[model samples]
Target: MIAIDNVLISDEVVEEQFVCDLTKCKGGCCEDGDAGAPLLKQELDHLNNYYEVIKPYMTPQGIRENEKQGRYVYDRHFGWVTPTIEGQICTYAFRDAQNVIKCGIEQAYLDGKLPWKKPISCHMFPIKMSQSEVDPSMEYLNYEPREDLCSAACKLGKKLKVPAYVFLKDAIIRHYGEEFYATLDATAQHLKEQKG
Candidate 1:
C-alpha cells in the first residue's frame, strides 16, 4: 500500500495496468452491477440541483425510473446509489446509437451544462473507495478491476503500458489534488526504478 495523508492506495493501482476499452466492454460497468452507480452525499444534491439540465441527456426509461425512484436511492449494503432501471442498468445511463451504455451525467458535464462531472465513485471506476476497516478515519483506494467485464481493458492496458493510476489521472486529481497525484506519480516512478 502507498500512503499519502489519510488515503491508502493499493499497489495494484501502479503495478497493474488498466485502461477502459469502452468499445469492447460496451460500458458494462454502467449496467451489469446489481445496484446503480454509487453516489456521494453531496452528489445527491448535485443530481437534485441539475436534474432539469441533465434530463435531456438521459433516455426516456432512465427519466421514468428517476421520476419513480427519486434522484437516488439508499442501499443497505452500499449506502447511497443512483436508482437502477428494473434493477439492472443505472437510471443515469443511456444507450448510444451503437447500443453502448454511457453516463448521461458526464455527457451533460462535457457539454458544460454542469460544472462537475458524474459522481466521484463512478468517475473512479475499477478503483473502489472505502473507509479503512482498521482505521475508520482513513480511506482506502483499492484497485479492483472486474475480471469478467474488464478483460479487454486489462489486455489493452498491458498493450499500451498504462498503469491504472495513470489511466485515471484526471479522476484522481479531481478526487484528491494535483499535489497528491504528483506524489503518486513520483512514487510509482520510484517503485519502477526499484523493480528495474
Candidate 2:
C-alpha cells in the first residue's frame, strides 16, 4: 500500500487502469448494489439540505421510497446509506433519456440548484474505501473494477494509459485535498519510473 498523507492507497489504484463506461454500464453502479450509495457522516446534512431540490428530479418510486424510508436509511451491513427503492436503485436516482439511471442530486447540482454534487463514494468510481485494520480511523482506498459493468472502462483506461488514481484525481482531491493529490501523483510517477 502507498501511504499518502493519512490514507493508505492500494497498488491496484496506482497500477490498474479504469474509466467509467457509462454507455455500457448504464450507471449500474447506482442500482446494481444490494444497498444504496454509502454515505459519510457529514453527508447526512447534505441529504437533509438538498432533499427538497433533489426530490423534483427523482422518479416517482424513488420519491415514494425516500419519503417512506427517509433520505438516508440505517443498514445492518453498510451503516448509513442513501435509501433504496426496494433494495434496488438509490432514492436519489432517476432514469435518463437513454434509460440509464442517473443521480438526481447530481442533476440538481449541475443545474446550480444545490451546492453538493453527490456522495464522495459515488464520485470516486472504482475506488472504494474501507477502515484500515491497523487503525480503524485510517482509511484504505482500493481500486475495484466491478466485473462486466466496468470491463469496458478497464479496457478503455488501459488503452488510454489512464491509471485508476489519475482517472480519479478530482474525486480524490475532493476527499483528500489538492496537496495530498499532488503528493500522490509524485509517488505514482516515482513508482512508474522504478517499473521502467
Question: What's the TM-score of every candidate structure?
Answer: 0.97, 0.96
Clashes of 1: 0
Top lDDT: which candidate number? 1
**What local distance difference test score does each model get?**
0.92, 0.88
Query: Could you give candidate 2's per-residue lDDT for residues 107-150 as a string of tens digits?
Result: 99999999888999899978998886688879889888788888
Candidate 2 root-mean-square deviation in Å: 1.1
Candidate 1 lDDT over 1-196, as tens digits, reads: 9999999999999999999998999999988876888888889899999999999998899999888989999998888999998989998888888888889899999999899899998889899999867888999999988889999999999999999999999999999999999999999999999999
lDDT of 1: 0.92
Candidate 1 off by > 4 Å: none
Worst lDDT run of 10 residues, candidate 1, spans 31-40
Give me candidate 1's TM-score against the actual structure: 0.97
